[model samples]
Target: MHRFANPGRFLRLAGAVLPWLWATALAVTAWGTAWALLYAPADWQQGETVRIMYVHVPMAWLAMGGYLGLGILSVMSLIWRHPLADLAARELAPVGAAVTALCLATGSLWGKPMWGTWWVWDARLTSVLVLFFLWLGHAALVRAFDETERGARAGAILALVGLVNLPVVKFSVDWWNTLHQPASVTRLDAPGMHVDMLYPLLVCAIGFSLLFGAIVLARTRSAVMERRIRALEMARARRADRPLAAAPATLAGD
Candidate 1:
């Protein structure tokens, strides 16, 4: 991990891997959508409306997963000073936030027909909302300082601090009397979902994860290039300010 901290190495590696990652993501996403929407049997309760879960559930899963990834990257940045770790965390913020927002929007859409309301202050919902805000906060904090390094450090600390919400969002249904249902997908006693439905959901989840990775890597690479350009510009500015040597002819004349 530390060796890969070198930007050149990182970029080369990413360039090699990104093509495969994107291809896999697109393939899986397409197959998953078809399987879930066309072949998977409808829920006994929600019927056709249950198809929304195909998108909603996976995005919700990725929302939390992306944050956890960012938090872990933050820890790595602070502890090991990995050059790209802060960039990774900073880049992950908007992607995670977008996914979380989608999760909420889709949830609300699902909720309207199922729960009879567009919004609720229930445990799972509220914690997920907090997760979105945390992402926003992380992005804002990282850019709040003139010193980019300091801002990155401050943002990393804030992200680690917000790690508490991840578990809360995960177990909210179990820990509280909420409107949300308990884990159907993740259960000790066999998945509450049939294999037919579960496979497509899993495909979609994996696809989303890969897509998130591709986006984050692309963003981080752009950030690193920007940083490099800024450093070069600063160096050039300093060089321009230096006094030039007087000509020998002028010295002789004086």
Candidate 2:
């Protein structure tokens, strides 16, 4: 684990793997979309509107999963001082927030036809909204301080505290009376969805998960490179300044 934490080593592995990840993600996601949108059996009750599940369900799952990841990264940052953890978490939040927002947007689109409204204060919906805000908050807080370490520490703390909401979001529908539907894909006894629909949904979930990883890894790589460049520039500037400082002392001595 420590071996993988080195920024240089991580960057090398990411570069080698990212192309494959992107290709696989695109192929799988396209196949899943094709299956879901065209061939998969629509719900007997909901008919064509059920098609939204392919996109919305994946987004919903990713949103929660991403937050869980952020929490883990936070734990790493706080406990082990994993060198890359802070940077990874910092890169992850915006992507997570974007995914969460898509979940909310897609949910609204799905809900309007089913529930006859664009918004609600239901437990599940509200908890998810909170999760979205938590993502945004981490993203913002991490950059708020001038000192990067201080910002990272603050963000890690916020991420750890925000993890309490995960269970609440997961169980909200079961725990409270809400228009939002219960878990179908992740049901304990058995999946509630039909095999045909379920297969494509699973494919989409896997594909998007890959895509999420690719995006985060790409962003982190860029960040590492950028920071390295800035450090080099600062070092060069200091080196150039040293000559000027020495000249004044030499002239005073003369």
Candidate 3:
């Protein structure tokens, strides 16, 4: 892990893995989408609207998972001064935020049909909403400082602090009376969902995870390249600023 902190090594590893990641992500996502949309049976009660679960659940899972990863990376960056960890955390923010937004949007879409409302202030929903804000806040804070190092440090601190919300998001439904359903797929007992619906959901979740990995690797590679280019440019500018050594002095009228 520490050895990979070098940008060049990280880039090489990222390049090697990215193509396979992308291919797997695309293939599985396509297959999962087809299976869920075409093959999975409608819910006995909710009917076709249950199909949205394919997208909604995966996005929600990733939203939280992505943030948790970012927070862990933030800790690494702050504690060990891992070179690429901050960059990786920075790259992950927008993707996580987008997924969180999708989760909220899909949840609203599902809620409108079943709950007869587009929004709710239930504990689970509200906590997830807070998670979204935390993503946005971290992104903004990373850019707030004039110095890049300062910004990264500040963003890392914010990420660690924001981690308090993750538990709240996870346990809110269990702790409070909410419209949101309790844990079905991750329960202690057998999953509540039937195998027909469960299999495709698992496929979609794996695909989404792959997709997230591919995107983060690509983005981190780009960031490493950008930093390298900036360093080279600054070096060139410093060279240009240095005065040339005075021309060899010849003895007067040798």
Task: Identify the candidate with maximal TM-score.
Answer: 2
Judging by lDDT against the true structure, name the best candidate: 2
Instruction: List TM-score per model, in order.
Output: 0.93, 0.98, 0.95
Say which prediction, candidate 1 or candidate 3, comes out ahead on TM-score.
3
Name the TM-score of candidate 3. 0.95
Question: What is candidate 2's lDDT per residue for 1-254, written digit by digit as tens?
Answer: 88988888988998999999999989998988898898999899999999988888889899999999999999999899775899999999999999999999999999999999999999999999999999999999999999988999999999999999999999999999999988888887999988999999999888888899999999999998888899999999999999998998999999
Residue range 1-254, candidate 3, lDDT tens digits: 88878888888988898999999999999999999999999999999999999999999999999999999999998999776998998889989999999999999999999999999999989999999999998888887888878888999999999899988899898888999998899998899999999999999999998998899889999999999999999999878766443223333335
- lDDT of candidate 1 over 1-254, digit per residue (tens): 77788998888888888899889988988888998889999989998898888899999998998898988999998998776898888889999999999999999999999999999999999999999999999999988999878988999999999999999999999999999989998898899888888998899888788888888888888888888899899999877755334455567889
Clashes of each: 0, 0, 0
lDDT of each: 0.90, 0.92, 0.91
Runs of candidate 2 exceeding 4 Å displacement:
none
